[model samples]
Target: MSAIIQIKNVTKEFKVLNRREGLKGSLKDLFSRDYKIVRAVDNISMDIEQGEIVGYLGPNGAGKSTTIKMMTGVLEPTSGEILVGGNIPYQNRAKNAQEIGVVFGQRSQLWWALPLIESFKLLKDIYQISDSDYKSMMHLYQSLVDIEPLLHKPVRQMSLGQRTLSDILAAFLHNPKIVFLDEPTIGLDVSMKSKIRILINALNKEKNTTVILTTHDMGDVDALCRRIVIIDKGKMLYNNDIEHLKGFFGSYRTLKIRMDGDLKQQAEVIQKELPDFSVSADEEWISVLVDEEKSKVMEVLNQLQKSHEIRDMQLEEISTEDVIKKIYEEGVE
Candidate 1:
């Protein structure tokens, strides 16, 4: 498949005012405001194919939002080029808007005092959707969200989850070829989040709509995205499939054992046997860290069972959260 979204060496910079400290210094600086250039996105480049769902993630001040804004044509890049569906988003915003949809978790595009159905009607008019297309789209969206009961309620009177669901429906009403979802499930309950995920997956599969999701919620990344792009300090850190990202840190595993006898004694014995590994124990449980390249978990367990009765054991792979956290702490290698 051809690349639907191409970002080439994109950089976005901002000139922020520098303020002086204390009353005397502040008074002197009021006449002349100094400024410094801060690059929120620096020399970043990637290509997203059509019909692909990608998770765009980063820590706060890591420029995730800045990148999205540039892609959506809300902000122009300081340098480099961004092409969505073969059009320059910042230059051909009106034409690009017809082919894309956007949803911001903290912002609403619906009328505040209007009924949900009325809001939908207004959007249909704004988009100039045909009667048959509007009805068909509503039918499909309602199947995912069950928006029947909430249609009569005013948007301002709905709950956070309800409002978000409504907003998502509104975004897709036009059936845009691409969509950008920014923290769509933020501040929602578990059930609401699940519903949102289901809706997103259904839309992607049914329409082949390309999606760019920006969120801190790992659950969203795990459920919907096979590929993820992470950035920090305005630089791209990692861009690959979820499994490949996990395999980057797959050399280590955690082994937890329940002992029939004294856990501390067993811990000491294991520690002696594997001097290079880190071993610790509590009342009834012992935990050991093993580097898979150097030692096998089964070998360690068999050696322990010879001296002490092993009640139970569990070997766990490191979680995606821990792996991403390590990247943030140590920077990408």
Candidate 2:
């Protein structure tokens, strides 16, 4: 199947003006601005198919939002090509808006004083959604989110989760083929986050909606996205299956050992014995990083067991968050 979205050599740059310090400099800046081009996105490209939930991840100011804005037609790229649903996003704004839905976590689309259902109805009119289509969408959304009870309450009266759920419904009221969700689960409690994730999953299962989600939550990436596109410093770091990313960054393993006896002396001994490994010690447990080739799990266990009584032990691989951090700190190839 052809990709629903194709981004080729997409680059976006913004002119940043230098601020003046003194009164004279401030006045000068207004008249003659000292500006430099800041590359928000640098020749990044990817393909996203229908029915795929992709996690677009990066640290703060890594151009994650910039990329999303370009995709949703909110911003134009400085150079390169972008096609969403066979239409140029920035060029054909109206047509692209009809096929796409966007939810920004920091902003609320629903009116504060209006009831949730009232807001949804307004969206229905704006989108020109058929009555039948509106009813069907409401049925599916209500079944997944169970938000019917909160529909009558004003947005200001609802909790964070309730407002977020309402916002999601408003975005999708038009039954857009593609959706862009920016930190949808931010600042929500665990239970509420789970609810939103479940609703997204159900939507994908039933409607095959193509979703591009940007979040810092590793759990969200693991649960929702089969593919991940990681960016850092306005550049693409990795774009591949989640498994491939895990394998690429999952080189080091951690060994956590619980000690039956006093850990102070034993921890010192282990550290002294394994000079090449990175070690940390607490009251009851000793942790060390082991390179798979240089050191094996069995050797570490066997060596540690000779002196101290090993109460329990476990091996932990690098997590998704760790991999992402590594990429940002030391640029991934």
Candidate 3:
């Protein structure tokens, strides 16, 4: 119920060699003392409360991974302080390991040759989980998903989705106070993604475990997180609830339409014509994010209908994904 993780003015810096352009420069670079300091996390601070699921979001090359590494005690911060459950992560890594579990996407903690249940049992032993606690976790997993089929299957034989699901379940098997999940639903289909999201939601509710999730998937953010922290270029941008973030772009509406023509070409044309609004297209829909104060939804639809044959059109409110994308492009004011 209190702040379980407190990060204060933490900074992580890396020293990179300044390599030269030419062959002679390359040879001289080995002996060269030139180096550049890159700050991956720049004086960012946040508090994660007990039993809260916080979405840690950023674009690629943003400081998400570096922050995670510091939290997990894989790397020590260059400056400032961090306390995970009142213990410094880097200083007390062994003790910290006992209290937190982590699952990195596509990187299985489960043994490849072992049956899924075998891997779970192995984790139980490693974490020293008791029989009663282990049974409770198993019961919880069964309630949300049918695990009987996947239990005996070797982890190597399971699909990407199945492996990811198994890895998440294993992470929670120890009943750790905190869990770090990095892109748990990556490379999964819609059905699998929905199932995993449901499982994560249920687990957090039932167990009251604090989760720090680093993901690019907006669906994950919408389904699992109430509070989100977004960062870019090693600097904190927004740390607030989803609604407050959306309120920044409150007047925007997503005009979704089904068209018969080339979606990519039509998207380019629409983007060129309406330089202010954002346009995106997929196989099924061309979603134009229109600022309602500047242009009406119907007006945008009418313009789209001019070149692209609109099979079906709907005016929907902007989604969390759209808002996040806008923030990524222009950043928060």
Candidate 4:
């Protein structure tokens, strides 16, 4: 089947004023000001298929949001073409919007003063949804989440998790073909985070809705995304399934050890000694990635014994988080 969304060499640029320093610079007689062009989304491209959940991974200012805005029609690309469901989003925003749903972090699409049910009804009217469609959406949502207790409560009165969950439900209420979730689980408690993940997975399976998720939480990615796209500094770094991405670092194991030494300082030393492997701290443990293909785990540890002492250790397969970190440190080869 053809892709539901297609992006070809898309790029979005912005012009920012280069303000001078000091009060004299700020004044500048209001006549001379320097501006520079910034490429927030560079020449990057990808295809999103229907009924698939993709994790849009990136650091701050990595252009994930910019790409999403272009997909949703909030902004148009400065170059290249973006077609969402066979329609140009920026050119036909109204039609594009009807088929796509968006939920931004820290932003609620529901009415603050209205009850959850009232908000749902308002969305139904605004989307011109049929009565049958409305009923089905309610039925599906209620099945996924017990909304009876919170249905009558105003949105503002709901807790943070409740509000985030409600916003997600409302976004899917119209049964749009595509849903963009931006940090949907941000700031939610552990239990609430699990609930939101389950709700989303269930919705995708039941409705076959395509999901484009942007998140920093690795737990969310593990629970929700089978495939992920990694970008940094407005450039596409990696695009593939989690397994394929991990395969890039095959024969690598994470060696976690607990020691009495200062973990932060020791981790830096180990990283320097084993420049090929990535090292980090996890609470009481100093974690290091041991590339068995390059050097046996014991051989690597034997060298580390030169200065640091290991009290206890455990080894595990390279994880998604580890792969991401390694990629950031060293680009995909």
lDDT of each candidate versus the true structure: 0.89, 0.87, 0.90, 0.90
Pairs of colliding residues, candidate 4:
none
**lDDT tens string, model 1, 145-186?**
788888999999999998888888888888888899999999
Candidate 2 vs candidate 3: the lDDT winner is 3
How close is every model to the real structure, measured as TM-score? Answer: 0.88, 0.92, 0.86, 0.90
Worst 10 residues of 3 by lDDT: 300-309
Worst 10 residues of 1 by lDDT: 245-254
Clashing pairs in 1: none
RMSD of 2: 2.3
Reference-based TM-score, model 4: 0.90
**Best-matching candidate per TM-score:** 2
Positional deviation of residue 56's Cα in model 4 after best superposition, in angstroms: 0.4
* True-structure lDDT of candidate 3: 0.90
Q: What lDDT tens digits, residue by residue, belong to model 4 across residues 157-185?
A: 99999999999998998899999999999
TM-score winner between 1 and 3, please give it.
Answer: 1
